[model samples]
Target: MSAAREHVIADLRERISLLEGGSARKVGCLPFGVPEIDAVLPEGGLAYGALHEFAGGGSGAIDGAAAALFAAGIAARTKGHVVWCLTRPDLFFPALVQAGLHHNRVVFVEADKEEDVLASMEEALSYGGLGAVVGELVRLPMVASRRLQLAAEKTGTMGIVVRRWRRQTEASDFGQPTASTTRWRVSVMPSDELPVPGVGRARWFLELMRSRAGECAEFVVGACDDKGRVDLPSGSADRSNTSGRSVYSR
Candidate 1:
């Protein structure tokens, strides 16, 4: 932690940021509007002009729904139209609307294969005209992710990838290395207790599996509301459980 060593590290970070088409001096972020969640992210929020990956914690209906809603919530908070490229046309538009991304603002591209979906995402991101570009893919290789990351950075657009797998075996690919800025997993948790015989707000277990220049962490919070925001349970306890391991290289 000497001054000379610190300076070298800072210089390297700046150079890397520049190469990624962002400035170290002032980078943009998309805060979740929740203090506890934002604090865990290196930049106090999800970094803009970068690629992020999301996947279900397990091969369950609830797990897939939670992960998709998590990504949709983030996209809902952005400014322009959203380009969502997917190989399957099974997305529930009503669920996305409930999560705050209205149908009018989304342009869905149905592709025949995962490769096509990635190609469409890269093209949309490179267009520099949308608020965010989302892709549904089962496997995101390092090279493919790198191209998507670079395209997003050049336009200062957010790139999101939802890793969807039809079989349990395909889920293993999500643990592989990718060039994304961060990776996340979301699983459904039991709803909070209610006084009456009625359903309460949905809860979720969120895991920050990987991040660039940041530590991995996890949290349990209420699911996204109509405003694309999550709420911490009463008391806002710290749930920073991490194994100190990263699935991807920095």
Candidate 2:
């Protein structure tokens, strides 16, 4: 090969490598306030401009609700606007507000079917300026997920997938391979035991099942509040009253 031609070929190879590495790029992150998770995540927190999947550990409404709220909290962290596509209209606005995603900043798009929700998510991601695009789907195949991933990279928008299934059998679909940058299983954990006879803050097990350039880890933190912020882990709390935002009802 001629020297000039060889140099051109090497440059082309470098560009292809950069494109391939984009899947695991540390675009940006939203901190969780817990050191354990932050220590393991790339770029200090959850990365934006990539698709992250979250599914409930079990096949029930409570589990599904927890997973949805988990994703909502992340959506609340996005800049500009948030677009949410769902097959059902059950997202309680008040609960979302508590998680920091306000009604005014969020645009909810209701779809008749899960397939439609996925389609909307991809389309919404294509247009720039939105902080994030979230979709609730029962099953997201690898091909569909790759399209969403590519769209996020092109536009620098976060993509979140909340996996909630109508049938118990369909819950198994979460195990299928996907092109998502991260995969998580969020489930409700027992709330902290209050010293007084009153309910305590809701807790969740945020398990990182897959990360392209990070560790598979788990975090148990106080669930998100009205501003979409999670408290430091209860074990780390010096006192129950230490956290100012103690109103925890979901």
Candidate 3:
């Protein structure tokens, strides 16, 4: 190889070593607002430089909008740019904003086919300096996922894969083809009644299917406010106090 080429390769290797070493150092965690769930994740939040796979729930168990909102809320709270690549262009931004994702931080890229979606997602992941990249596609090949994982690692960003329910068969069979640090399944839970009239709390069941750090478990989390941010349901004592305050004020 030419001297210039050798020099370039050496420089690249040094950069990779720095990144790998820095990844081991603890960066502050970004809370998802779900205490129980966060407790299980490394760094007490989603790990950076890793792939996170979201398994599709059974029919009617979960909807894509709800899942998008859930993930979007996390991205919003982390205060980073999010690239949402989807095969469908019909994303409900209003709902996403309601889920606490700032419209300005989100960029929606629609693809005509699943292949295009994967291609776009890979590109977005490679661009670097993003908070998170979310891809909603039918089926993601294991090789493609591995490439994305490497890109995310180089950028120190998070990658979220939202597989369609119809493709659950293949996705589940393939598992997470990359060296993703974690995998989770999110499903909508029955809404809880709010103290106020005409309002209800959004609930979800988060199943940690795979984690590099530990065993998997299921937890329940509820979304409060119009933004759909997840948190643990209030205790009875807290609820009673809230009710008393409302009554006294009235």
On TM-score, the candidate that comes out on top is: 1
Question: Is 2 or 3 the stronger prediction by TM-score?
Answer: 2
Q: How close is candidate 3 to the true structure, as a TM-score?
A: 0.74
Each candidate's lDDT (Cα)? 0.82, 0.79, 0.66
TM-score ranking from best candidate downward: 1, 2, 3
Task: Decide which is better by TM-score, 1 or 3.
Answer: 1
lDDT of 3 by residue, 1-250 (tens): 9999999998888788655533222235566666677788777878777777775344222444455566767666654678988876666566666677767888888888888888887887776667788988656677888888887777677788876655445545535455667776666655667678754666666678888876798766674345536777754222211110000011
Give the poorly placed runs of model 1, Cα more than 4 Å off. 1-27, 235-250
Identify the superior model by lDDT, candidate 1 or candidate 2.
1
**Per-residue lDDT over 30-149 for candidate 2, one digit per residue giving the tens place of the 0 to 100 score:** 776667777888767777778999998778676677787888888887777899898778777777777888888889899998779989999988776787899989999999999999
What number of clashing residue pairs does each candidate have, in the order they appear? 0, 7, 1
- lDDT by residue for model 1 (14-122), tens: 7876566444322489998889889889999999899999987886555776788889989999888899998777787878888898999999999998889989999
Error of 3 at 232 (Å): 1.1
TM-score of every candidate:
0.83, 0.81, 0.74
Q: How accurate locally is residue 122 in candidate 2, as Cα lDDT from 0 to 100?
A: 92
Ten residues in sequence with the least summed lDDT for candidate 2: 239-248
